[model samples]
Target: MAYTLGIDIGTYETKGILVDHAGAVVAQAARGHQMLVPRPGWAEHRPEEDWWGDFVFVCQTLLRESGVDPRAIKAVGCSAIGPCMLPVDVMGAPLMNGVLYGVDGRAEAEVRDLTDRIGEDVLIARCGNALTSQSVGPKILWLKRQRPELYAQTAHVLTSTSFLVQRLTGEVVIDHYTAANFAPLYDVQTQGWVDDLAEDILPLERLPRLMWSNEIAGEITGRAAAATGLAPGTPVTAGTIDAAAEALSVGVDRPGDMMMMYGSTIFIILRAAERVADRRIWYAPWLFEGEHGSMAGLATSGTLTRWFRDQLARDLDPAEAFRQLATEAAASPPGANGLLLLPYFSGERTPLHDVHAKGAFFGLNLTQTRGDMYRALIEGIAYGTRHVMETFADLGQRPARLRAVGGGTNNRLWLQATSDITGIDQEVCDKTTGASYGDAFLAALAIGAVRRADIAAWNPAAETVAATPDPVYEKGYALFRRLYQQTRDIAVELP
Candidate 1:
């Protein structure tokens, strides 16, 4: 039977799946990795260890556990956290740790400089994005200025998935969806790389060859085969960012369908009927040709929960901490007994685009229990999500259908709170394997084994988190917004 292999490199873990032609998962494997924060406002990952290493381990594990012949895997697809900036040498070796996505704010100065030099209106018109923490061009400029030696030695700049695909096929390439994140470096109108906007970022030659997400980039080389336990010459498609793949996995194909990914961050992607030229949200060419996508995300979500567990819930076992916390949180009422939180531990992304934003637990009282605090934390994230959705609404691009995916969906409190605050029903798919499952489906599409519409059949929605409005949430959300605004000056001034 024909099969496909899908693997995704996430912020905290790497997951892989083996799937048969009928969309049933034959086997699955995963490996965990860390998102290194060497310094404040910076995030990095060791490409060799965290990315390729986890990939190799997961792929081999899937093959061994499934006992499926490597040759039976007809095609391969990959997705990863992005758009990361990893400059590699001519031999395709990383010059330094990969700079992570918008969560890493090391290039704030560069972002400002570029925006001031080239007007935001021009940037929005040409690049379809504003120079925020998410833009790769500023990060690249930061590298050129801060680390000239490495920049001098750099051959090509690649994102996480580009690095992975290159390691597999020996063909350096990137997908249009991921490439769009390289604002000022990529022109949306032409759908190609351009060095004309702030030419000092890098020569256009240093960028990868762009392809659509489902296009076959190249075949696996013998060297890659040896490392991955796959047959030599196996076709691999040009993969995309993890969130995009996750969106596709849940049947988010048509315009107005949004995927609310509750992973390391709460990433939201809405397929748009046409290009959305708004700085408040991101715009990129969709996986398929002639389609458009708009995106928004919080700086922290699941990561914040992990931090709370690690710091406050130290008595609980690591494995059971989240579950225990969820139980405790559920006991608290809708308003979290008058507690509010700002989930800006890593700064804010989208809408606000404020890198200096601070996380806080406002209105804390001695009477409030740990459960109340936990509930407030989850509610804060929900409020942030509602803020994003409202922005889309103001732009006349609100989602008609919202599908929730990723690990956070397992947290009933978090899921219900998001719906309660946002007042949007969230459809949960049967398979929450997320990007890896989406990768498998995309692999099938690349090989003509499946069509885009087949995703609904592969992973049908099993349930919906219905919205239940409460007056408490209405007051809390208002306070949530006001707390951020009133404290913004003090927050940014702090060291």
Candidate 2:
């Protein structure tokens, strides 16, 4: 029987899956890793250890456990958290740690400088996006200015997925969906790399060759096969960012369909009928040709919960901590007994895009318990998500259907809170294997094994989180927005 293998490199883990032609799972394996924070406002990963190492481990494990013949796997697909920044040497060795996505705000000054030099309006018109922490162009400029010596030796700039695909197939390529984040370097109209917007960022020649997400990039080499226990000369598709793959896994193909990914961060993607060029949100060419995607996200969601467990819930067992915390949070009522939290620990993304915004727990009282604090934390993330939804609404681009995926979906309180706050129902698919599953499907599509519409058959909707309006949530959301506006000046001044 024919099969497809898919793997995804995430912020804290790597997951690989083997699926048969009928969409039945043959084997699955995973490995966990840490996201390095070398300094405040900086996030990074060791490309070799965290990305390629985990990939090799997971791939080997899946093959051994499933006992599937290497040649039976017809195609391979890969994805990763992106648009990360990593410079490699002539031999493709990493020159430095990979700079993560918007969560890393080290290039804020570069973002400001670029915006000022090339007016925001012009950037939006040409690049289809405005300079923000999510844009890789500023981060490239930051590296050029801050580490000129290293920049001189840099041979190529790549994101996480590009690094992985290059390692696997010896092909230096990037998908357009991920390339859109390289604003000023990627012109949306032309759908190609351009250095005219800002020649100072870096030479466009250093960028990867662009391709669509499902196109075949190259075949896995003998060296890559030896390292990962896969067959030599296996085809590998040009993969996309993890979020886009996750959206596809859940059948988010048509315009007005949205995917609310509850992973390390709360990333939202809405397939648009056409380009929605608003500075408040991001726009990118969809995974397929002749399509567009509008996106938004929060700086922290699951990561905030992890921080809380590590710091405050240390008394609980590490494996059971999240479950215990969720139980505690569920006990607290809608408003957390008048407590509120601003989930900006790593600054804010999306509508605000404020790198200096600080996190806070407002309206704390002596009566508040750990349960109340935890509930408020989850609620804060929900409120932030609603803020993004409101921005989409303002643009006349409300999603007709919202599908939720990722690890955080297991947290019932967080899921329900988001629906209640946003007043939007969320559909959860049967197979929540997420991006890796989507990768396998994309691999199948690349080789003409399946059609786009086949996704619904592969993973159909299993449940729905119906929206329930709550007066308390409405009141809390108002305070949440007001609190941010009133304290913005002070938050930016801190440290």
Candidate 3:
């Protein structure tokens, strides 16, 4: 009765699953945590408490609940929100809270500085990405300039998954898919750490060893075994980011097979036939050796809904609030009765990459209700997603099939609105367990229990969200595009 253990630390929750050799989920466990926002445009997580602690709890819970022998668990796979910026000492102890991905805009100044210093063309040619808040290189520079004392004491700069992998196996390694986001620090052509560019920001030695996602990083140490209640010497794979694992979970492996992840933010990954170098979107090496990956993300998606639920629907019970909002939103008509929203609460990513962008509700009137506002908010995010998809189309990289995953996929309004706005059908798998399930499959791959092509058989797509074209959405999407351009100057001036 051999099995694999998979765990993923997401923005607001950590989930773990145990799967038998046949890909049947034996048991699952999850833990919720808070995303600390110290100030505007900054997001951080206490790695020790939120990441490692959750890993330990989930592992022990899964083993206890399933009553599966710890020795039966073969390989372990992990994924997390990334490419986060976390400075750790030589012992891999956290020196500071982990800075989140594109949503954290503290590196705005550093992004501009590096783009000017390194030349956008050179960066794009070498790393296949431009300097933006999402680029970990800029975040590293921001740390050096803003916290020189801490930077001086730093021994390693680790992302969330790398941190967990090291904790599990005492090996500091990162996957190529995740490392590609470390723009200006990672060389796409060379597929390795760029010493010449990274040395200027931080020593190259501080970077983790690079490997493909399926490769075994190291065996779990005795110390980790004791903490996790798993047997010592269990193999752990070089895992990837949550979105990549989520994509894999839904069998997004072939060229033009895309996965749209509706989580804290909306993340899109498309399997490309070849490496793409574009300023509007990022492309990188895929999980396996030969394939290529193209990606884009919105800064805020699910988070906007959370904010509304907390602030506007505070009187309602937390559990009931979302349902109430959804009920009202579903009842509202397509255009939300002339209300429009820009879901730039955490600024914009992907095509715009505008850190100064601000969220707004346009056409709000006395007639508008909470349900109307909520529908408009979801519709705005859908429009933003369509903007990214159009960029892919411009590059001749439109997705042939779209797989939907993550917590937001469970929201009918959001998913249907996205379909309507983008005019692309979305396929949904029977198991929307998200990234942890993908991690389990990756673990199975590392142990030779599953083939690269076995994912479809393991988790087949069973449903689809077909595009429902609406005249209102057609006109609103056009207005959505114009609103951003007309309001850009004003958004930049916001204090």
- For model 2, the stretches where C-alpha displacement exceeds 4 angstroms are none
TM-score on alpha carbons, each prediction: 0.99, 0.99, 0.99
RMSD score of candidate 2 (Å): 0.7
Report RMSD for candidate 1.
Answer: 0.6
Give a tens-digit lDDT track for model 2, residues 174-276: 9999999999899999999998889888888899999999999999999999999999989999999999999999999999999999999999999999999
lDDT score, candidate 1, position 206? 95
**lDDT scores in order:** 0.95, 0.95, 0.93
lDDT of 1 by residue, 313-345 (tens): 999999999999999998999899999999999
List where candidate 3 sits over 4 angstroms from the true fold.
none
Ranked candidates (lDDT, high to low): 2, 1, 3
Show model 1 residue runs off by greater than 4 Å.
none
Error of 2 at 309 (Å): 0.7
